[model samples]
Target: MTSNDTPEPTRPVTLWAGFIIMCVGMFMAILDIQVVATSLPTIQAAIGVAPDQMSWVQTAYLIAEVIAIPLTGFLTRAMTMRWLFVVAISVFSLASLGCALSNDFTSLIFWRVIQGFSGGTLIPGVFSAVFLLFPQNRQGIATTIAGVLAVLAPTVGPIVGGWITQTYSWHWLFLINLAPGIVCAVLAVWLLPRDRADPGAVRRLDFVSLILMALALATLEIALKEAPQRGWASPLVIGLAALSLVSGLAFVRRSLTAVHPVVELKTLMNRSFAIGCVLSFVLGIGLFGSVYLMPVFLAFVRGHGPLAIGTIMLVTGLAQLATAPVAVVMERRMDARLMTAMGFGLFALGLGLSAFQTSATDFEEMLWPQILRGVAIMLCLLPPTRLALGNLPPSQVPDASGLFNLMRNLGGAIGLALIDTVIYGRAPVLGREIVARLQAGDVETAQALGIPASVFASRIGQPADAGTAALLTPLVEKLALVQAINEAWAMIALLTLVALCSVPFARAQSIASPQLQAKAGH
Candidate 1:
């Protein structure tokens, strides 16, 4: 048996205890990322920060995650895996407290950067821990449980934040992190194994690559964030985008040739890892893209409050949490390809349903889509995670896990920016098109087809009164705008389905049977 495949000594605590601790860590991290999203307006008002500065709250965390994630291999190996978890939890918990007490945006952003350093390690560390804690046969179940908890944080964060913000204060969003973060810290220390650093291990510490990656990702993130507000072709935006691409390419070249790469090039060369990276990127597009678009769409079109939107999303988050066990069972019964495809199909369907939304649609209409998403996410996430690390050399698991999650978070940041630019760019044009058609008696055309004049007029308005029609035009025009958003959702759905096509290229790996373990001299 591989060192990784051996079971741990039976202790008073069960494997589930590790899962619980990991979940608490994950919940705190995810909660912090999103809970602040719902409270940004309040935060800005409280601190008297400019709107542009408010974006830094999110940008700082994401930048830190991006900067820290690619370095996990070095970090994990330099310190043992267990100490990494303990340190990460302790740092994240302390930062959450600092965030709660921060009197200004600068202070909050500074602590958030600290939080990111700790939070960034948590996912890869948690995944590595699961693999270490469980035998290969049970990896699927372990990963599935981890995936469910990971998904739970983002889905529930905003909902919980909204409730907390509305009922108490926006400061509570950061305050809420403190209790869970401390719990996670305590559990991590008590339950997790301590690390033993390899003093002789190579630590490349490439100053140039680190700087390039940070600058490239930071520039790209900034460009994406600003593209919607300032046109993409604007001088500042173009300069940043160009710098991002050039620096990114330079880093890629440097990383590939470096003796001790910050990112392990060889690991990503594996077909499974390559496909997994692609899948993770696509997932970023879907996960963050929707999160960016949906709440704003609901608020603008249907006028829902953050609390109401959060409530609906809470149900979805709970559904995701509930599916963890089922996903674990399914992983054993199904092929990675089939399970991933089914998951993507459900996710696409959810996004597809969202494509047709109108302002008049009730809150209930959104719930089912979110439910479908919960299912799809659980299905897709577990299998890829299993497939990626299932066959890796035990020593390389930490690197693989780190790269895998880095793509997801980077994808989230970029994806949100891309989708936002698209909707903002297209919605106005679509609105105008509908307004023009209605003024031309697309209604008269309807009336000519035996639809009543009153019905046509009530719906699309009289073609003759151009000024009045123009004044009331947004009502009819918004349907077209809604359809444009649907188009975006449809594209995301299709992208998920397209991601499934990569599954054929993935290597098929079977779990080691318990019987096989017994036969093999266990």
Candidate 2:
């Protein structure tokens, strides 16, 4: 016998306090992902991690999160929404404590993996509540509240992380979660309904499907990370990619055949939901990729510290705040498909604008692009959300929500990998070009890189000394880096534009699915 999600009719919930706490819990979880991002160097030194091993600090959490995200519906059903959230938050908080207490790299990574697995469920969990807990008229407002925080946490993470690291020890990053976590947990138990956990559900769990999915997602994430660094053809990268593909295919087959699938793989067959997932994927690339790109350029190319980069990043977050209300209003009145197109068009334009950046590009030049992406983010989120989960029957929303949210995360992971591939792969080639241009006395090229005319003249026709070559190396590297960054910017911008191709095919979705309508007819 398979698991069915249909619930007995219950009174509509107005548990505002519990719901708010739930959103806050989700926000904290999302925020921590980025909070640690800007402070990785401080963390690396404190934990005495080697430079080569440092990326794992972030990767471990991400790989775990990616694997866990799709299991949200399964876990929610087994434990019930109320208890699952409590358990996840408790574990997440304890993991935070463990992360703060770790004295070595190995221990920190261990805690991070646990932290990510628990935290991953919070995102889709809250979104599922929007449909399950609220009526049609109110879902717009609830979703906006959740969406703003969802996008906002990541946008503001750099500033928050930078401030925390600069003001106190890096341990404060994780320690900050302890109080909030405790409070949220207590409030959850008090305010949420006492839905009994199903011991039978746990017993019937499909372990084979679970293992396949975990292996597939984990290997896929690690492969994405490795491909850019080690080259796509590297043996280790190829093996990981192959393993991921095989396991992923097998997982799909198992889910389709199994009586009690861990996740609802059939959710992808819904046309609007599928398109919405694609849009979500594209949004993730632009959203996470932009956030990722801005910091790298600032820290590496512009020689800015964490605080300064955070200041510059504030533009995106501020824009997101200002436009959120208007977006909510528009989403109610407009056709979701048109709104989606307009949002992606502006977003693509925003991304395209950054592709022309030079080594000298900074906050002012970055200002408009960030603002455009920021304003566009609300549209990207609100409409696609409605398209994806809006029409699903209440019973199916949790599982569908997990799959919808998963696409965005997977997009972020893949986008970052491609961005890195461009930067690391193209930089050296461009660096050699810059060196050749400099050797051939191309002052125009030098001037474009911010070298003054007089400075170019002074260096021309001079015998290259060790000091001169040392002085020139930095410039060549910076020029190459900015150019490669711009190329990557172009790559994602085009991908965003390409996503628009699918919007035309996405039929406008009604508030309720046909299954719900049929049930209502009775």
Candidate 3:
């Protein structure tokens, strides 16, 4: 009954069952992250938190992730995967319950950080385990399935969140995690393989490297988060940036010397893997940057409500879900580099389409590009991930996957911080310029200038009844803000295109497992 290493790989029913359970866990984790975003206003009121302090819920989770990701490899080797998973899920689920029951923001944020640490376990473990479950030839398929979860979870998260937020209290968002978390934990105990941790691996932990990485990532994350509010040169911001630079350098030095490192620096030495990481960084910028920008744009510029904004993004999410199968099918035959290029290229094109938007642009106009973006994302994200780790030794898969995700997540943090700083910084200047050009009743200039003056006045800026002399000026200001945001999307598109260049260097290989061969042959 046991499918431990044998000459012929036996189908592990338990592995497939574990995959199913992990999918649910993945769904809950991603759903909570995004779903609660739309529900934040409601939660802030329910918990009586001020707007300035509300960000802690997300900050706590992200900080926890930063701390947990590098430790995953060491942890997996130190504790049996099954027991580790059980403990992680148990903590995450209980944290969810605590969140649902919490009466104040401080208490909620506390449980959220706890949830962050526990929830961090699902990704690398599920992905690495899935690779182990399938035979070698089917790794592409396994990875694809994993990719679908990656893409779909964030997409469906908001839709589910919207429905729950509208129907139940915001507490439901936190409560929802409990069911899946408990189920995933139980399944892990029942069907999952309990691979015991080797004691020899415990001695290999690079404590200094771990500290340096945590510090580097934490400082960088803090610097990025603060940039949007406190201009880049703010002393607090500048100091964190300096600390991040020093820590980043220290981590690199330690990783090279440490007998056992948190990250396998040699794996990154592969040209393809390194290049793939560059694209991943760019992909992170687009994926996460857009998630931050679009809703803000839609709500502030387009005058959409939380439900409406959620609905619009739900389209992109659905489109992404639709594209997953195609990516899965195509990766099997096509070189991953080509697929990565295609994805980035399409994403670039989609970004270009977004730049053309104005206050007059309607939902349909946005949908087409979203569809394209979704397809492009699947193309860009999956292949690079596949190529990045494909050439590494089988034993290195977990560590590589952890590093890959860590880099991408870090890229996302950078993107959000940078884009927000750029857009928010430029908005007032752009708004003033637009006002100068379009004065009210200057029909000749507005008509000849191709301004949607009426739409702008109604849709953008601080809503107000203005002086007759400046009646149409707000219209111009609104368009300018909208245009500025579009410009941001354009920047992301160009960045994604640039990321495509890295594809040429991706290594052309995949990890092999004999069990995979036996299953396929059977």
Candidate 4:
């Protein structure tokens, strides 16, 4: 084992406190993405960005963020976790401040890239802390704490953003990170364990590997971003995808033979860990995709504003909160594989329920599906976490954790792209079908669009005039959108089921209980 296995130990309470603070820091970073997402239109208008260019704000952040995640393991070694958290949080806070102060889109996006790169470290850092700070018995409790906040941010972000946007200005969406970030950074410095930063390790860094990895992830993120809008066959998207693939392969080859590779590629040889990563990737697809899918359907099909969409989505968040304690308890008592199966099964079922949604399906129809997904959140996370990181030696946990988290993000990018393709590609064809049916005086189609029978009664035997067609066009579009979104829901549901099938392939990993470790120490 490497020197990383034997960490600087502290009192139990202090260690838990430090970990909690790190979790909070991670929550802030994650919440920032979703919060800003819901208010992007408002921010775009305020910053004087043209509509077409606004997607860059989010794209810039995602590209920089993905490039930084795997590098966290190296940074933690170069500068110990305590100092790294301090430095990253400080930069993130300063960037947030800069974003708030920026009057133009260019300045805002510049700060966003910096913010994302720094914020990316916060996630894997906390997961690494789970193994580094706590013993195996307590790791479940720790994972639950971090996992809840990780998923909770996206669930609640829209509402928070909507409330802030509606009550105050869009600037507060970013400025909200300031106070908590400063306080977290200061506390992390004092409470977290520290080790000496290595000066010469910086010299050992392989800059070529670093550049290749960054290019690969950056180009992949951009390619995924563009593929849905410009078809995957688009020459620009193809070139970007090819570049990402080539760089990724070269980086892998270089990493395997390097004197001191940036990331530990050999970690995947562990069967449980590799399968656990697949589970994480599938979870990312469902987690981020569902969160993304709901807002789109609610906003576009139902015409709900950001606040209302957030409020409706709150059901999932509330259900998750209520079920967290139960998940923690079950974690200590059950077989992890069994828990993973149940979690993904329930999550898939939840996704499937929405597949039957009609255009008129509203609050009552959505409640149960959201609750099922919420309750499954912890189940989906804690078991796979144990299966993945619990088997690794402490020395490898940092790098292993980075790769694990990165898989989830990569899954989210790919899943969202697929969801968008389903929506954008199929909507027009479905729209045409609905239009043709409506022209034939199909009452069922009209009723599905929430148009009363009386409204179409007089026009049943006649062709619709231009005015009538114009009036019905928007309703037809909403109907088509609802159908397309339902298909997207089913698609993710199938993906989650595939995750469930992989669960049994993960062999059980043994972890010593805290009591056993204490006696051994004695």
Q: Candidate 2 residues 280-352, lDDT tens each?
A: 9989999889999999999998899988998899898899899999998888778889999999999999999
Estimate TM-scores for all models. Answer: 0.91, 0.94, 0.90, 0.96
Better of 2 and 3 by lDDT: 2
Off by over 4 Å in 1: 1-15, 199-203, 444-477, 517-522
Judged by whole-model lDDT over C-alpha atoms, candidate 3 comes out at 0.74
Q: What is the lDDT of residue 162 in candidate 1?
A: 83
User: Against the true structure, candidate 2 has what lDDT?
Assistant: 0.88
Tens digits of per-residue lDDT, candidate 1, 68-108, equal: 78777767776666566768888887888898889887798
Pairs that collide, model 3:
135-516, 136-516, 456-475, 457-475
Model 3 stretches astray by more than 4 angstroms: 1-10, 439-466, 510-522
The whole-model lDDT of each prediction reads 0.76, 0.88, 0.74, 0.89
- Per-residue lDDT, model 3, residue 111, is 94
The true-versus-predicted C-alpha distance at residue 59 of model 1, in Å, is 1.4
Best by TM-score: 4
**In model 1, how large is the Cα lDDT of residue 198?**
59
Higher TM-score: candidate 2 or 3? 2
Q: By TM-score, how accurate is candidate 4?
A: 0.96
